[model samples]
Target: MAGIKALISLSFGGAVGLMFLMLGCALPVYDEYWPLFVLFFYVLSPIPYCVSRRVTDDTDATSNACKELAVFLTTGIVVSAFGLPVIFARVHVIAWGACALVVTGNIVIFATILGFFLVFGSSDDFSWQQW
Candidate 1:
């Protein structure tokens, strides 16, 4: 039941984050859809971890290297997600307000992703290994 509730909450957070991203792009004052590109980052953020998990042994206590690399890649993807809006704003590709909204969305979305992992990662019911 707790896991179900957590899943619902994470889903809600993801929706809210996407709402912010859409607003940043669709708002009348912003009128630019370039900020939607951040969605790619959001999607890419988890790939490394998923890949590494498949390549390495979870039961091995010394299997930190692959996991560390995944973490490193995830971090870079997240940072790049945050940085993209700023770069767009600096380059006048998007307004400052749009950048702020995109950044806010990035933070919320990433938090939700992490929350999903924290909440369901270890539970037998949520077998990420099958992903």
Candidate 2:
């Protein structure tokens, strides 16, 4: 499960990065807005590594994974919140509204990650009986 998460996260991150880079070079009007995507990419960048560690059987790996997950989610929320106004002010209405799509996607991702963490943490043996 975590491996799948890691792969998806990395793929999404890479696509976002490449898209921003291309946008920065190809579109002068959107250059300033490109940085917004760059920052968002960075905020989401740790998810792959965190999810990779998350599925490990080792205690240390699990601890680090939890920490990384917490950091990624926390930073993501903070970055998005701060960037929202800036994004709204700088981009066109249509482009700015696209942020809602971004936000909804990110929220789903974070919820999945956090739910797994919570479920694992609450269980003694990671069994369904705990639920």
Candidate 3:
């Protein structure tokens, strides 16, 4: 089924994204684990939207304030994720190369997360909660 294929590809992309994140920590030239903190941003990015979906009514579907606020929060979370690496690099906690790697990983991971929402979310037919 298309869903199965989509799942496999998304999994592959996530794996590659994680591999990049690990490399930022594992590679010798810029060896440090502090950059891994971006994982928190990655994890927290979707929470607001999920909560907003539960709180707002879909039927009445006029411009909802809660959903907009959730989007604003999500944007802040994503920007923070991107900013974390730059901060680490600026503070000399991690090398620029490591920061670059982490940034790339963040992009890939975030894209995968978006893809997941597009495919498995926004549809009553497929619910990620079951997984």
Off by over 4 Å in 1: 58-63
Model 1 earns a TM-score of 0.92
| Tens digits of lDDT, candidate 3, 1-131 | 88889999999999999999999999988889998899999899999988987887674777889999999999999999999999999999999999999999999999999999888885576678566
Clashing pairs in 3: none
Cα displacement (angstroms), candidate 1, residue 24, comes to 0.5
Clash pairs, candidate 1, are none
- What stretches of model 3 exceed 4 Å from their correct place? 59-62, 129-131
Ten-residue region with minimum lDDT total, candidate 3: 122-131
> Top model by lDDT, which number?
3
Please rank every candidate by lDDT, starting with the best: 3, 1, 2
Each candidate: RMSD: 1.6, 9.3, 1.4
Candidate scoring better on lDDT of 2 and 3: 3
| Tens-digit per-residue lDDT, 6-88, candidate 1 | 87899999999999999999999999999988999989998897788678766467658888999999999999999999999
Native-vs-model 3 lDDT?
Answer: 0.91
The TM-score leader among the candidates is: 3
